[model samples]
Target: MTTLPPDETSQAATPAIDEPLERLARFAFDWADTLCDPDHGCGPYHRAWSMIRLLTKNSALPAGGAFIADGLHRAASGGRCRVLLAGAADTGLVALVLNALRAQEIEPEIVLADRCATTIEQNRLFARHLGMRFELHRCDISALTCRPVDAVVMHSFLNFLPVPARQAMIDALSRALRPGGLLIAHQRLDVGRRKHDPQPIKENRALLESAARARGYPDPLARAIGAAGADFWSNTFAHAPTPEAEFLVLLANAGFNLISLSRPLAAATNSPLFIAGQSRETPQAAILAERMPPR
Candidate 1:
């Protein structure tokens, strides 16, 4: 267990503003203008993503860019690697992950697994259009039976699960990785402490707008986020944010070494990328090793 110094802040926030804008602009261009509706309690849940952008333009870690390509490239060295993107919402992020892998010339058997049927269908089209090939598994991640892999990538998916389910998912992920495998997740670290509804609409809008501005969002987009705030809180997530320490404990107990935790974007959850690895001593590692196909 690596003892990391305390993080500078723990407040959770969404992904940098550009990702949603880009996705919407490209795929749902018609709705791009009003994606953030003022009537909604300010869309706290809508498009409130928090993950490092893998593309080079926003590759700065704290500037809403991802740093996983290098880590993953190193991990995937030696041979072809199996990678899982659990709870894959759409193929948008998957495209970026693919770019990273391709950049390293790492031949990966990529699995985009999620439970939503509609999402799966949509992703098929998205994947085909992007000319990327991957296997799509449509089921809850906790229920997946999979080959052990070198790495798994997640974003804002675990926090919505109930505690028990979340734990099971972690266990399942542990079983799905080889010894020394990495689980890189971008998660919300402070949502549990957020104030729920009963707060007036005006106040909520003001709060959302403030957050948007703090992260340097333009006035129009900031106002749109404020507009969607209410809907975001009510409909977006199923569970409160998990404190970083608690989540780290869960990772540790599950036999993972905490390699890094970094907040690359601004959002309510301090959406930090957690890079964790399976250790040889963990019970899951022992079981997984036997089940793993010969390297």
Candidate 2:
């Protein structure tokens, strides 16, 4: 575990913002609505529709749908499968997962969980529009009771929680799965500093240093480097670019047997870390107890 020195001023400067999430939701809804509106210019709707089409293209399912489909397929073989979608705001991932399962002729009982009332309403509306059945729980995941589920899929939710909260959430998710059941989670990993042709490290570091100094920080250069390093590790290692080693260790600790691990095959682009594992009969609580270095 790598630890980066805390930058109090920098931390204070960065406000808690959910603008990214809201922007994404707005984009999706706006794009979909525009495309469906008959009066809209063909150009705008065409371009947006094409993008959504490309995003959900079946050809990409092999890699994009593998984690969720693997669990769904396993549950399908057993005749009945109950799936839990933690923090399934807007049901974007849920739509994909359900589409994949439906393609395989598997009817999965889904429980969509999230604390946001607006998001819950949106999910319910979408589900109604699609004529699909799902139980929506408007509550924090931590407050929920653990029950036997065939699978649990968490997409980009763990990273928002602090380390301890993340660990507890993982433990809860693991316990929710029945023995031999599947757990699919997607996280972001942090990538290390690398030289770029168009954008050199010197320029990037200098810009960061300037930002730190502007925020009234002392030793801005060192502080900038430390901040950049922390961001890189958190995004690449802890959240986005999660290493296989760390993932394996995490699964082992959670009493899960690794079934498959996959990364994007295409050239580097923004993508989620896809992982799948199975709950074990003999819980590995000891492994979970092993302390990991701070992020």
Q: Which candidate number has the best lDDT?
A: 1
Off by over 4 Å in 2: 1-63, 190-246, 267-295
Residue-wise lDDT of candidate 1 within 172-200, one digit each (tens)? 77778788887777555655423344355
Task: Please state the error at residue 263 of candidate 2 in Å.
Answer: 2.5
lDDT score, residue 125, model 1?
Answer: 58
Lowest summed lDDT window (length 10), candidate 2: 279-288
Per residue, candidate 2 scores C-alpha lDDT tens digits across 1-295 of 2222221211121112111232333344334434333432222322222122222121121123444565567655456668877774344556657765766777767787766554565566656666776788776676666566777777655544545555556666667677767776644334322223322333434444454455455684435333442332223222333344665665677677666544432222212111012111110000111212223
Global lDDT scores for all candidate models? 0.51, 0.46
Instruction: Give all TM-scores, in the order shown.
Output: 0.58, 0.52
lDDT of 2: 0.46
lDDT of 1: 0.51
Which residues of candidate 1, in runs, are more than 4 Å off?
1-65, 192-236, 263-295
Error of 2 at 290 (Å): 20
